[model samples]
Target: MRLSIPIQSHYYERKRIMRLFEAKNLTKKYDKTVLDHLDFSINEGEVVGVIGVSGCGKSTLARLVSGIEKPSSGSLLYQGKPVDFKKGRKDIQLILQNSIESFSPRMKIRVFLYEPYHYFYHLHKNEALDCIKKILKQVGMDESCLEKYPHELSGGQLQRIAIARALIIHPRLLICDEITSSLDHVVQREIIELLKKFVEKNHISILFISHDLSLVHEFCHQVLVLNNGKIIEKGTIQQLYKSENEVVQNLLKAAYLNS
Candidate 1:
């Protein structure tokens, strides 16, 4: 017999009032400090872009938020509570730049996509296959690709599969760490457009990390500029364009020239 799951009214209420994810004084250090005390938050369904020059702690911040690395000092809260990366929370998902490295070469694409569903939802084989087919279709992949190994696919195709893997778990917040840096301009634009549609349709929030300021300006609702591990500037694209900060100005100039 199928069971009916009652929706939690408080979930919607919290979505209206609380941030999907929040970081307060988030710091990470190794031999040297990588990320300083950083403060940022993303509301439900908001796309927040993080941009900085190389070595500005952009990837470090993504690691901290995604729970790949622990913070030395600071707090990360998801849904108004402390984030427990160890618990394997499905609400937060992180997609990395190297999709091929993330997968097992020995395994077929179907295994990569099916494992999450089986583990998280305990679905039967047919059920898992159905879910996988749906997600693959949404990501513009066909069934033939499912039988291929990771090495058999192109970079853009693997990246889309990685995205489908993340979305299969139904995450509330998605952290993308330079996911498009490896792709060409056309592929990057396609991925960004796909993410925009996914975010709008599912009401999911994204923390997009990229060095491409032009892409960030086009895609993000708000932009955070990180310098020396701290947020040096943050604003909407228009507000940032009007700012006089040297760092922001330099980035804007670079972006303009690149475009």
Candidate 2:
């Protein structure tokens, strides 16, 4: 299964605003400790980035937030109430890193896009088609691919379409799990630009998880450096660069050097 999000994350204190999604003492264990009382939040209309090494529980956190998996011993609150995955899912959308397996092999692009519309809004085919057309164009695609299966498109095209599909239902929170990791730098920029435009136009909150520090720095307003299931560092891009923590310092060095 792909990563889903809201992560019951913790929002910081700079703005003193209420959290859109907040994770309190979140802990998950699979074979061993995956998350250990982790804490973070996302405010309304904010883009919060989570950066960490591979297998560092980033995906686990995403799953918990998205309701794909539940927290072992913690509370996930949305707007001061316990999040109801059944209804909360409508307001949260997740875009995974794997665009290839994102859809069913038997389904056409049309069916995939229309499912959310029908399920959530009960929109008729014609109404859904209209919205899909607009979203497709927004994600730099068109209606011509409606008849084609996922295999017929390029990686970039599939990813764009995946994004369009998620945004179609107008979720308040978008969870991105390494969505750009598989694309080329150019395609990555295009997708990020599309997200930026959408965020500017909509009051959506985003939880962006990535291994690429550079990409996170370019896109997120604030970031948390995840390590051993806890946030070791949290701040703006510029502030992070000035971190005195050794782990943060080494991570910055490695990320920039590889970039």
Candidate 3:
């Protein structure tokens, strides 16, 4: 006798712009592997938190997904198709923690914002400047920032400006690699709130990478726990909080109970 299992009708109801299947086994060095084997899926418009220890390769995984770094031997499928680094999808963008280094020391801040449009949309100088001003305003940065250099701004301001540049392109998948780690707690909260608002309004998918599990819990719908490049645990925010894994338990304790 054969038996058929029933499927939930609503399981396939939601729409997704991109999905990462497996995302496994990224071996950086033969002797000391960075990511042993990892797995997670991010639905469109979902905020996926990546939480792990300092050396667990959380940022490395973000780079891999953004095509900034190549995985040694693992497959990453974006929208069910394999990720091709050489011919990368233009809709993906990465916001690194140290936004200062990401910018050119010689260029003005406005150039940083307009350059992407000049490449992708062929917008003229005046049009690009207007677009840049609009995005900078959206991120709570003043027009005066457009004339300043990276050295002229504070760490928090630079980070916000960097985020504005990333959002200016209206990317579908935004990879944030510890983007607010250096900011003050107040600024951090504000930045997170701004990003959340953008995601809600634009339907953008976010892979937020951070070592702070508490922050992740407050922001993401689902969380992926990484240690030495392996996914020790992964589930919804509630499930992760109630997880029994020692590393996760300890991290949560340190962030909340211990602190």
**CA-lDDT, candidates in order:** 0.86, 0.85, 0.78
Model 2 clash count equals 8
lDDT of 3 by residue, 43-67 (tens): 7777888987788888778878888
All candidates: TM-score = 0.92, 0.92, 0.88
Candidate 3 segments exceeding 4 Å error: 1-27, 257-259
Deviation of model 3 at 26, angstroms: 4.4
Tell me the tens digit of each residue's lDDT in model 2 across 1-259: 2122322233344456556988889999888989999877788878889988888889998899899998889899888788998988888888899977879999999999999999989999998898899899999997899999999998899999999888988888999999999999889879888887887688688999988887777778788888988889888767888999898888888887787
**Candidate 2 C-alpha error for residue 103, in Å:** 0.5
Q: What are the per-residue Cα lDDT tens digits for candidate 1 across 98-180?
A: 99999999999999999889988999878899889988999889999989999999899999999999999998999999999
Model 3 pairs whose backbones collide: 35-229
Query: Can you give the lDDT of residue 65 in candidate 2?
Result: 88
Angstrom error at residue 232, model 3: 0.6
